[model samples]
Target: MKLLKGLWIGFWSGLILGLLLKWIQSVTGEQVYTLLLNVDFVPVIGSVQWSEITEFIFHMIIALVIGVVFVYVAKRRNYSFGQLVLISLLMSAPFPFLYFLLSWLAVEAEVPAATDWSAFLYWIFAHLTYALLLPILYKTFERKNAVSQ
Candidate 1:
């Protein structure tokens, strides 16, 4: 049940994050998502043009892994939902930086200019959204466990 909750939360959180990022980029005239998509080593195998179905599946898998890991790590630390969310956010901080670095190196693409505050802000917003949603999902699942037992 906990696992199922995690997966469900992950899907919603990931989808929301993706949509929010896309919206922000569209408004700001920045292609932040495109930048991340173009960055190699982010695990998009096969042709660069992945179908929508493939992308959805890949995102869900990634989100599920992140959700499960976050819950497991937080439980191991004996932390509450808020603490787990905070820790997960902190843990995920390196992903964007690594993405930036990899984009700079392997892709030969100039990283989004630091002057582009909108891009950075969009990235932060997306990360925060995912971090915030993850714990809520865990809490909901925990409640189900309590009620069932």
Candidate 2:
């Protein structure tokens, strides 16, 4: 049940995050969305021409993994709403830095350059947005789980 809740939250949050990043990129001409969906650095996966939907599914799969782990920890620790939010934010803090690694690894990919301050800021914003959703969605699902259980 907990796992199912986590998956639900992850699906919605990830969808929103992907759409938000794509929208931001469209409006501002930033490549943060490109970074979000880029798996071109992977040995075999990178070689395949993935459509936008496939890339989004890959992104959602990552979010689902994080969600399950996050919910499990939150339930175990009995974290307050504030704690959940804080932990989610902290967990996401390192994500923006991944852009640097991605830039280096996926040289042929159309992601933001390692030194692009503006794109980094946009990435930070997108991540923070996603982090905020985690706790809220978790709380919502917790209520439903409690009722159903």
Candidate 3:
């Protein structure tokens, strides 16, 4: 049950964030995901450019896990909006930064190099969106559940 709830929150939040980021890219013509998504992984879901599809799936999983963790951390406590915002930013930043840094230093990864500012900024804002949405959606759902119950 917890997993489902988390996944639901994470997946939707991730999707919404992803769309928002895409829109940003479209508008700015900026390569927001230059580092993170530009990889040479074996295509698991798409044609030659499997990264697109795989990346989306990866984000959904990340968001789901973030939500689950939030639920656990949140428990019965009502976090202030600022706290939730901080939580969202904190929740979203580390994994990719570490992953890219480690992969680049440790394994000569084919993904974007660590200094890709555009990608980093995109990553931050994308996570910010996810972070922002996760709580709002989760709280709304929780409130509705409580009302029904």
Instruction: Tell me the whole-model lDDT of each prediction, alpha carbons only.
Output: 0.67, 0.88, 0.64
Model 3 residue runs over 4 Å out of place are 34-36, 41-51, 76-81, 95-120
Candidate 2 local lDDT, 57-88, one digit each (tens): 99999999888877887888788999999989
Cα RMSD, model 2: 1.5
C-alpha TM-score for every candidate = 0.74, 0.93, 0.68
Q: How accurate is candidate 1 locally (lDDT)?
A: 0.67
What's the CA error at residue 128 for candidate 2, in Å? 0.7
Model 3 C-alpha lDDT per residue in residues 1-149, reported as the tens digit of each score? 66777777877887787677677667766545433444444343323455577767766676677788877766557787677667766776675575455336423224434676665666677766667787787777788889999
In the predicted model 2, the residue pairs found to clash are none
Off by over 4 Å in 1: 39-47, 105-115, 144-149
Worst 10 residues of 1 by lDDT: 38-47
Q: Which should have the higher lDDT, number 1 or number 2?
A: 2
All candidates in order of lDDT, best leading: 2, 1, 3
Q: Please identify model 2 stretches exceeding 4 Å from their true place.
A: 145-149
**Candidate 1 C-alpha lDDT tens digits along 1-149:** 44666567777777777777667767877766555444344455533756645655666678787876776676666677778777877867776674456345444333466456667767777777778887777777678778999
Best by TM-score: 2
